[model samples]
Target: MSEIVTTRQQTPGDLQRLDEAPTPAEYLGRMLSDRPALRIGTRTSPMAMAQAGTVQRLLDERAGVASEIVGISTSGDQWMGDLSKLGGKGAFLKQIERALVMGHVDIAVHAMKDVPGDVPLAEGTALAAYLPREDVHDVLVVREGSKYRSLDEMPPGTRIGTSAVRRKAQLLKHRPDLHVDRLRGNVNSRIAKLDAEAQFEAIVLNASGLRRTGLEHRATEVLSTDIMCPPVGSGVVGVQCRTADTAIAEALRLLDDPMTRTLITAERTMLHGLQGHCNSPIAGHATMTGDGQLSLKGMVFTREGGKFAYAQEWDAPDRAAELGAYVAAVLLRKGARGIIDGIPH
Candidate 1:
């Protein structure tokens, strides 16, 4: 089906539900084949719009469903300071999720990493689908025409920019001399600072995020997992809808990649088990093994990177969550609990 992409801006608030809205089952049964355009809610950030557009395209191309991208300004977007002040990562999602519940949008799109693993899905909502995984790696963003092309190549006292404490901890653990300073803003503004000012030698960004924003060429070098472990749910786009919308949920599930789903299940299970706050320097990754088993690796680090714990475990693909919990158990046994408690998010 040929699809037309449409963008709409919606206000986020306690929208009054239509007094006589159709029943949940009727909403699905009413238009299985000839449905109204699905409204996809997302933040208004450039990366967010790009991610939502991708979803709009996929639903049209793969499922023959039409969609409209709805951009909602969220609290996280409005607040430039510490995210912890607005309730950590949840700040980014509150308004959009509320729109979904209010019937202002039929679905919500999110970068899975931004979703807090410790928090339950907002009441009455469910994660219905996930796009195929992208590169689950961190990359270096150095100034154009700079001599530094990679992490190790940079000299001592080199100042690096990043927002996530996980990245800071891992970077410090790798090179104690290099400085990992907090850098915030959308990817574009962050890169702008690298070029306009001499304050930062380089900045680290997600490889997948750069690709989604069509800025992959800016990546100076891809950091191997050995050097920089990724956060849980990186490189994945998750779709959320009302819990009672079973038909819509199943339709979206058709677009999901099973392998990616299992991997995320493992990674998120570990994250939930750890109960690590947004400030906690916890990292975990899951990948399919060559032998058809699932391998999960998890790490916990002090904010300063001096103390850490790591564990890796394997299980059948069907046991993704089991492998995740087992790995968390191993890390906790090795004193991850103490390190996690010491950090104040």
Candidate 2:
């Protein structure tokens, strides 16, 4: 490991700042006896680093902890050139989680959607907490000067692009006349494919992706949940650390937003119970109301949207998991299982 390097010299304003900044020694003292540097393992992608950096900054401000990002190239980033071909979810998180289990990182930060339902953390490792969510909607980006305002408005046979089976199925179900195609890459790369190659008439992308990459301006239309329910845990940030590392968990506690976590918990449970992943044609969304209740909306659809199965909203914090399970059961009862099993797998 290299010595910790500060990019900028300490200035009067930085020194006087009362937001709680810790020296390297201070942070290291709490971590291990040798006080090795705090290594935050993360994917090298721009968006991944941005998310990790945000938490690192907050750790300093809120907990007086200092750390550095240890960029690790994962399989997901390596094969960004072709994602759809790589089956299943957890594509982006497996390597990072492995690094954590191998003691390369003290803590791991992740976009909740990318994390697998089955994470085998080392004996003492555990998920610390999840941060608040961002907007959970998919956006449509068409070439400039396009008169189409919605998917229904687009001409039949229009080429639609997406990397997720969930989105492809949902959109096709709504507009059977349109054609869906595979799109894979970072936000910038996807945009290039659309603009340069004109390979797709429009692309369905997570609204949060656009915000994270500062490309929201390209969004021609934001599809609501009514049109396209987002993937489970789409916009939440999750933090994981060794379960024995009480100090790190306590330090990260302040970052947890309980209400957001509660709602996302239901969404994730729904996904898990349904055995769904990035490649599955599954979509669900959850929201918490001021009346101290949780509401969840979920759906299962075919790739071409020829048929769909949906479940009603369930409101009950204590039964959040049950609510999700109930929805899946409902979908199963509605012939969703047959449709799901029919996929080419």
Candidate 3:
């Protein structure tokens, strides 16, 4: 089993200053030239590569910097069995993060949803920036020959596939008569199963992921958050670097989206407060209202979807963490802890 770790380091003062350069672009270009092309560590998945490309593009646009993608075969991607057996979602990031610690990569690009909220970041690493968010909705993708076009259209005992415990609980809660089974593999393989005469009438997936894979056309319907509350940290790509890498941090800061940061912060804070495991069916979503207030909703469910707790709250955007904590406390008061503890990992 790979462990999630990175080197703890301290930044040494550079004698150079921004004012020393003729312009901001020139300054950044000079700074970038001080080292080899920036190395971005990522998984080998199409989605992961797409995210890494996005970072590279942003760097070129914002700081006149070039980058190289360092694809890593993470233990999570290599493991074909259940992720829970490997101690949950952390399996996906441990090796890639370790690469950063070993100086093989300067930055790590992660689909924020794949990151585990229950644990702090690997030692010596920090989440420096969040790319602007994409649509966070989960969508239904029906098999080509299936009779069902929507969850409501499906008759009793209709089969749906998804490996996420979050989706399973939510689906059962919404339509208990429909059979929800675990579907494994990446988006391409999962869809191949559906098109390869598998038993699933439909499979649920994230809209942004579909878009990233250029498979959005395969989606049958976009589900509302009310029906399928997104998991925490959905629809965002996070940039992570060594904690002491001041130059890297400064460069990544240029790509940060403050609004996305606030939304993800609130959602992730609530998730961490729940102390959820991989099998814990927890869902959360946060949004900025028209008037600039932050609204957060959180949920917890039992494995069978027979028991659950939910809470929503509002606060100022700057109080994102406070709002998340408040919603988490409310849900706990509503028995979210018992529901969370009752599930098997």
Candidate 4:
């Protein structure tokens, strides 16, 4: 992968300033002078294509630039087994990032939740901007003719299909008698399986994915955050690009939602601090209050759902990382470390 290119000329004073210092508008203005047509790399899934289309529309409206979509097949797209065994969520991003690094594409559009907390990126490539977030909650999709309105309403030993360890743990924690089975595939595939296969009574899925794919009508119940804490970065779509490609970066910046960025940064920071991967039974959700303060809630559970830790913290929006770390520290002190360590990579 190509390394990130830094276009800024660093001076002694610039080196002394904090890294968080804002870039001068003059610099951004100069970069915006040329709106280069961009090629965005994305997975071939319908939902992924829809997300890329969203980015394409935003670029047309905000940056007045034309763009083409490039469909890239990722390891996660082909893998039929467990995601963790294939290297967690990073599997979904590797080929897309490769396309950016190789100059085949100018930007990579992805679901933020599919991004691993600490995966290394090409030196010059970074997440440039986050689109406005969608509903950050999980939903239950029951088979047709099922009378269940919620997980609690299901009968004991009801087979629930979901691939996420966090969802598995949370479901078992609340209903020990429910049967949790691994359900793999894209959003449409999972729903099809739930409807056509008699083995599964219901399945759990992210609300954002369903909404993005126009399948929200299939959701039988939208689980509250209190009932099921969302994964870090859920509901947010992000654009990644070479840092040195200031034109693309500035163009994508037009789509950045400040509050969403702050909240996702905090949640991802907490996940990073805990060294949690996609398969780890870890959950976090961050939200901004009307007054601009941020609150973060995090949870960690054992593989068997026998032990768990939970913590929450609040801080200024600018201190999102600090707040995430604080809550992570609290959870670790409460034995979250043991829970995380016991999970297989």
Candidate 5:
């Protein structure tokens, strides 16, 4: 597996000042200079920068363009206390998007799941490319000497940790017998906490995160997407850029995975249609079939675990957005509306 080569570290003092930051024109001038380089904006986290580097490399290879990264601090990174209790999913992405809009950087790379379903980029700004999707399942990283492999394998009253209401709702729906507790921190920190303390018997993390960090050794079991439908666009990478910048857009377009984008469009459309946010216990996944059609699957559940609904739909690639809306409507008719409306945002 290819890994992200860049590390997330504080920018050297020389590069920290905005006065030191070049204008969009200046940056593009540098790119078209005798030594060309594309600049990608990303949050300053090991996992995030790693993902950014992966995209940078792909853009370099496929577009015949060299690139470098500019690590930026996002609101989500500054205030890690309570995501939902703060300002919702937008906290994770707003600053980064603002940087793009302000021309601080030419491109922005993001984890698709962290991005909200209804991102309101300026009319001329859009997701430039979608990378190949990785494994979309959740995984249980159990404490050493623990016998639990799958979520079901955990005993009654077993304490599990997770920050996502969607994962908590889904896990409880299947195994109400287990205990779900709150968890926070970067990937390595979470694992260290779980390993060093007895607060939780295990913690649930995205398989893609583990794989990206080269920590797959900790996975006790990969929870099937069947039981744990992934959050929208869980394992994909998306690059955002100004729509008017046709050269940069075309450069990024080379890294776009058509199948991945088609599937993510359906999943994101379903999320947008349901008016779902990170606070809402919603999970959706869409797959592109061999025959070139898109198949969608999704679930919406209540916070109290009282009500739940699932829906699946299929359509040709061209109708990806329509397919997602139809599936959401189906789930809505089957009591999903009640669950969505009742859930706290």
Candidate 6:
């Protein structure tokens, strides 16, 4: 076996070398007669397990790789309070990432939206690929038999539970009378609370999560992007691996969907340029046109939802990151800086 290498900073030369390396199958055939089984690391939540299963299946089909699922608990899972207070979306990722960096697992699967805009990857680790995306819209899950069909139709002062600052701000912007309360837990727990306690009229959840968990029927209405733009990288699953492990990285690349990667790059680039975290009321989405141009739309809102700014841009697909940065600049010029700067760390 090769000695494991761990290095934090990657140079341009290192990336060039990896690009020149052989594909996983090619390398494996030449170096080892026996195929190595991989261990995939993920959070223990049912939704996380389902996502990991997707990646496992993809690897098996695409690269003829064998793998085992390894569930890992994270700080984000243990914390019961606001995610914002725990350093945003990355909280859910730290422990899983540690296992990957320490070689306890060969791969880390993540809900792309939970990946921080500024990813703090362990030494030598990189996001190798993205799976085909799921629905990129937010949905309103009202208690079964509720008369409310959508956010606009809900009665004034209707309480909606959600931990996402982006959802809370947008819901308030659309209907100032709606009460936004903090709601945290896995998909099942939140739904159970909504059904049994009746503390909230509805709750906002990612449509992809519901679909992944086989609970899509729970969503009363899929909120359109017009009403609620999704957070950056919302509907995708990212596969992370050590960059030094070219075999694993190449195998994961077999699952990468080019269009999904392009869209998420633009969205994440926009978030990175704006210096926004999960706590910030930031939302962005990118789409590829039939003509090959990429369109990016982004929004930033005041913490209180009293004010907001939005911007959009279109460019060649190859210029996705540039388009994201351009949109961020446009929003900043429209006084979005005040709103973003005011968010608590």
Give every collision pair in model 2. 124-243, 173-305
Against the hidden reference, what TM-scores do the models get? 0.89, 0.85, 0.92, 0.89, 0.87, 0.89
lDDT of 5 by residue, 131-221 (tens): 9999898998998778777776778999998978888988888888888987877788788889899899999999989988889999988
Q: Mind giving the per-residue lDDT tens digits that candidate 4 earns over 1-345? A: 999987988888887786646454335444554655679899999899999999999877766667889999999999979988788889999889888998999999999888888777778998888999998989999988788878878999899999888898898888889899899999999888888877899999999899888999999898888878898888899999999887678768878888888998899889888987666898999988788789999999986566899998899999998999999899999988888887777
- The candidate scoring highest on lDDT is 3
Which stretches in model 5 have alpha-carbon errors above 4 Å? Answer: 1-36, 290-292
> Which lDDT tens digits does candidate 6 get at residues 166-213?
899988888898889989999989999999999998999999899889
Candidate 2 runs further than 4 Å off: 1-37, 80-87, 118-123, 144-149
Instruction: Please report the TM-score between candidate 5 and the true structure.
Output: 0.87
Q: In candidate 4, how many clashes are counted?
A: 3
**Window of ten residues with lowest summed lDDT in model 6:** 26-35
Predictions in order: lDDT: 0.88, 0.77, 0.90, 0.87, 0.83, 0.87
Q: How many residue pairs clash in each candidate?
A: 0, 2, 0, 3, 1, 0
TM-score quality measure for candidate 1: 0.89
**Compared with the true structure, what per-residue lDDT tens digits does model 3 show for residues 1-345?**
999899865444333543354566557677777789999999998888999999999998887888999999888888878899987889889988899988989999999998998878889999999999999999999998876778999999999999899999999999989899898888888999998977898999999999999999999889999989998989999999998887788889889999999999899999888898999999999998899899999999887687899898999999999999999999999999888888777
In model 1, where do residues sit more than 4 Å from their true spots?
1-35
Please give the range of 10 consecutive residues that has the lowest summed lDDT in model 4.
22-31
**Could you tell me how far off, in angstroms, the CA of residue 219 lies in candidate 1 after the best superposition?**
1.0
| lDDT tens digits, residue span 146-235, model 2 | 677577788989998888888888787778788898888777778878888877888888888788878899998889898888877888
Decide which is better by lDDT, 2 or 4. 4
| Whole-model alpha-carbon lDDT for candidate 5 | 0.83
lDDT (10s digit) by residue, model 1, range 78-126: 8778788889899889999889999999999999999998988889998
Q: Looking at model 5, which ten-residue stretch has the lowest summed lDDT?
A: 24-33
**What ordering of candidates by lDDT runs from best to worst?**
3, 1, 6, 4, 5, 2
Task: Identify the runs in model 6 with alpha carbons over 4 angstroms from their true place.
Answer: 1-36
